[model samples]
Target: MNDRKPNLRSVRELTPALEFCTIHGYRRAYRVAGSGPALLLIHGIGDNSTTWSTVQSQLAQRFTVVAPDLLGHGQSDKPRADYSVAAYANGMRDLLGVLDIEKVTVVGHSLGGGVAMQFAYQFPQLVDRLILIGAGGVTKDVNIALRVASLPMGGEALSLLRLPLVLPSVQAIGAVAGKLLGTTALGRDLPNALRILRDLPEPTATSAFTRTLRAVVDWRGQVVTMLDRCYLTESVPVQLIWGERDAVIPVSHARMAHAAMPGSQLEIFERSGHFPFHDDPDRFVEVVQRFIDSTEPAEYDQTALRQLLRTGVRERAISGTVDTKVAVLDAMGTDERSAT
Candidate 1:
């Protein structure tokens, strides 16, 4: 057995500060830092506030960085109830109400991105600006790898036995076997899960794990419905940041977002994966700062700014579609035409 420690560069930068809030009939934990316009930081699936440590630290100089460990992940509670984007958004709503922060700039990544979009839709008055990083709300295009992970038999091998309903003896055996060989294989498809378990604060690991899994399967339906239409009623200064190499939620989703919200500004980073902040923290910081700095740009020049929206609409207009199978596999019914 390889007993060497996992190479974790992400958690090293995290400065965790705890806060308690109730969500889904359970007390949840979150981390808060800095002070300015309330900036609620949301994380992707299988990750916690720690994933935003690098980006949050940079933004803290200009905004209050509020990164929460979503319900059932990180230090939060993990109940047996099904989870969904609406649940996560409601969890956020409860958190914000408890904090007494009326309006905020919500930044969500991956699953958190989907949650952020819903939050904006449900509580438009509470959100001042929106930033979605490789977000998954607007498009039904999900990674094949993640879809595979959702299957009963295809999940992490240890998860097969560690189920909340499983026998203790079987779970124990699976835990031992999992510690030996299961995690490595699971990490190949679910990178963030491996990262979450390794970086989990304490006893919260097991529950958070279960909750995250439940959230994934439950959130798909409602989120897909929300994405079919443009949710924001008023212009709220939307910004999108996508990784060119994102395998989890392809950058194609950004294109969909641009099409849906024609006013949003999109930034695509080549060579970055699911978590572009990990790939290039400095560049991420720069892009976000630029967006915030130029927020007050001339209102009359909206057309020029709209033209600069980088969610790949112009590119899509040219290329049309990458692969028809992507649409069929995602089950996102839409007009399909082959690229010339």
Candidate 2:
């Protein structure tokens, strides 16, 4: 007998694997791959667990990787209600509960980062460590256009009625905009930005882009404040991964987060952009693995773990076998520019 690889269909196919255990009310689709201690991965807006494919593959060798699609995004059900960060966090908590995972290191990106912060704050006992990659919840001032686009009327503004043949116009404008925009303004390197946009899944009526925008705009300050309080109370070890060229949520936010959570570690990816994982998976995995190794529970079987985490546990954090240099921002600095 042979076991065929699971068919990679639409995002919805991921649900059956993840819903292996009962999560009451919310049907969150998830998948558990590799073997070892559990590591829960939550993705940001407009992305699914597939985004973590590379990192998950590497980490799975060391731990049982549980990656879930947030309610509205991947294969999970999208309800017809305003999505709040708190709700998303709660959903994750329930997902873990049903999956029989009492405690695990939680990793989140962009919007998912905010969700992870909320979860760690709300259920500190359940979270061993927190890893945030370009997470949100710092400020309201996002991209000026995104800010405008998120408004109630903004969605209408994007329709072809406002600008006939808008999609074509957007493509043309994006081309010229790329030329005019600097690295600091484009959010990512021109090539990377183009790649990200080009690679975005083809839009369907149910794409959830607008819904994600609403969540991004609405889910703000309150969650961060709660996370700050969590840091003060629990002080769970935090690992922050940031891209130097990320303009969507500036690296300045990481500085603020480090100050707010004194115990947190910050790693800035130089010459990298918004989606650092896409640009440099090895470095991302290195830093995350270090944080996990630093905080792994003693109860877990070490010898078994060695088999799980393929690479040596003591390998360099940001660099693997070869040296990879990076410019880091000192959290303790008063001058933010000098720090970054």
Query: Evaluated with lDDT, which candidate comes out highest?
Result: 1
Q: Each prediction's Cα RMSD? A: 10.3, 10.2
| Clashing residue pairs, backbone N/CA/C < 3 A, model 1 | 72-208
Tens-place lDDT per residue, model 1, 86-191, is: 7778888989988989888888998888788888766666877888998875554576645554555444443544445444554455555546653233222234
Instruction: After the best TM-score superposition of candidate 2, give how far the Cα of residue 35 lies from its true spot, in angstroms.
Output: 1.4
Per-candidate clashes, comma-separated: 1, 5
Off by over 4 Å in 1: 1-16, 22-25, 154-193, 197-226, 231-234, 296-340
When summed lDDT is taken over every stretch of 10 residues in candidate 1, the lowest stretch is 331-340
